[model samples]
Target: MAVQWVLVCHGLVTLLVVVSFLCGQWPIFQGTFIERIHFFLTSGAYDYFLRFVGAVFGSKCSNAVLSVEYYCCDRPNPILQIFYLGILSMTYYFIVKSSFAYIPGYYLSGIHRYTSLLAVAVGILLFLLTSFSDPGTINSANVSQYLSAYPYDNIIYAEKECSTCKIQKPARSKHCSICDRCVARFDHHCGWMNNCIGERNTRYFMAFLLWHFLLCLYGTVAIGLVLAGRLKELRVVYILTVYYGIENSFLGLAPHVAQWLLGSYNTLILIAVFLAIVGMLLAGFFGYHAKLCLTNTTTNETFKWQEYMSWQRKLNEAKASAAALRASISGMSSDRKPLLSKWRAFFQRSPLQDGQIVQNNVYDKGFVHNVVEVIYPLSSRPSFTRPKLKPT
Candidate 1:
């Protein structure tokens, strides 16, 4: 009972962490406690703790002791990177160790084990690539070039200089306060990677996500197969067979079978449950990134777009109210029109309809083009030169 309680608590904590990570990415939670918790976790406390342990043990550590203030400020720190890598490695180790030993011999005969190993290998490779890859940093040398990449649409993007970088802000570029640098087509700073995910590294990040999703999915399925094999071997289903005046219902036997399965394959069942939950979460993340790729937008841009829409809505409402007031004071017959009619007029004349509120997304060429751009970044494509920006 104690062990069961411990496992339950562990699983709940894992679930909560995963949910909090997802919510942290959402713009709605920007000022919420979820964001604060996310900030705290991503901060460099782990790094400091490790250094302290190392110092106490008289270990020779090369890295300087990072200030707590700097850590809390969200600067690039590798503390969480080790934690992430350790968790992934531990998960892979358990899956390989447990699945090979406990699963029935017949189920492990084919290329199933080889396929799972291959997925893990590929996932690790992608993870390394994403962590090390450059995320299109904007330096003084390439600032002008980046600026000419996309024309300013004047709504979400405008011609201005970054106060910190003191360089002209590119159309899609953003200054990352965490990294203390400007990034081209900046998406968001991913603490898991211990790096930014911008134009150059976004593709690698997405591929990493895909590969990780596959790894989790493969692990879960393999464990589930092992559980099924154990069930078949035990014939727990047949043992619970009921033969009486009452019909033999599988429903009646299900609870007993489940209890037997849980007791028999406890460890495998726990691993499978954890992998399945994490797999579903990864799938959600993958789908979101896929949508962003299709729309030719970044996480940063998506939040900005949401804010712009909200402001536009408010402006439209204000305009409608003013128009109604004017019509009333003038004693115009149009004042008698339905509220729907007034809203329609507002919509027709609103800045949104007139292309003032929502500007043309200069970077969005087409679906195929956008996908290609992400996969083969402009920085790598030497033959492609950005067109000159037209005067606004």
Candidate 2:
């Protein structure tokens, strides 16, 4: 019972941390404890650590630490890329060391051994493709092509020039500070890949996400089958029924079976739990990016749209308030106006509700075209080459 409780607690803690780290900034979790934890994990902890180092080790040491942090985080360094590879390799090593012997036991076949290796290799290949691929870097030579390909919506995007690159910036392009280059259709800089996911390599990034999710799921299920094979081969049920005099019913035998598994295969159980958590996270991440791709939106564009909508809403509200105030002043009279019933007023819709601002994504072509564009970026097409500028 104590062992079961420990396992339960471990799982709960892992889930909490993972969810908090990944989704603490989400609207649903805003103003909650999860958001606080997310802030600490993402920014606050590092900030405090820097302050402590400054206090204990003086300014010189603090400056050195800050330099290291800048290079690792603010600059395009391979630290996270290396960490990703390390984690992947280490996880595979641990699984092989602890669970490989049971691959061909009872429920699983020997072919899984090779298949698992192939799956991992394919995942790594996808990672490499995303990491090394050109994310549609807009330079002086290709600037015209990119500019012609993506038109400015005049809402979030406008015709502009990159001050750093000294080239015409296309709509939806952003100058990546870390990479020190302008990327067309910029999504975000992915630390794990040490690369920007943009027009050229978004497909590879999506593939990498989807493949890893499936890989984690496969590892979890295969390990489960191996454990099941062990249980069946040993005939633990038969032993429990005959020698231990336990009932054959599921409810009667479940606790003992769980205890036995927990006692014998705790390590495997832990790995399974870890994989399951990671798999679910990857699934969600992939789904989010998939939606963005379908809508022809980038992560950067989402933030832009949020800010644009907010500003528009505030502007409309201000205008409405001014109009109402002018009308109220002009219609001022000696007689008192009748007050509205509390219930009626509470349920009434605001007159300005219809004026609410909504996101108007001008770049969102139909679903199929948007998906195709991600897969085959505009810059790569022959028609994009030597584009003749024309009146909009």
Best by TM-score: 2
What lDDT does each candidate get?
0.77, 0.92
Best by lDDT: 2
Write one digit per residue (lDDT tens) for candidate 2, span 295-375.
Answer: 999999999998888888888899889988987886685466788899999998885796977788988989999999998
Clash total of candidate 1: 0
- Writing each residue's lDDT as its tens digit, candidate 1 over 198-273 gives 9899999999988788778878877877777766666656656643232347777666666666655667767887
RMSD of each: 7.0, 2.3
State residue 301's C-alpha deviation in candidate 1, in Å: 0.9
lDDT of 1: 0.77
* Candidate 2, residue 159: lDDT: 81
Off by over 4 Å in 2: 1-7, 333-349, 386-392
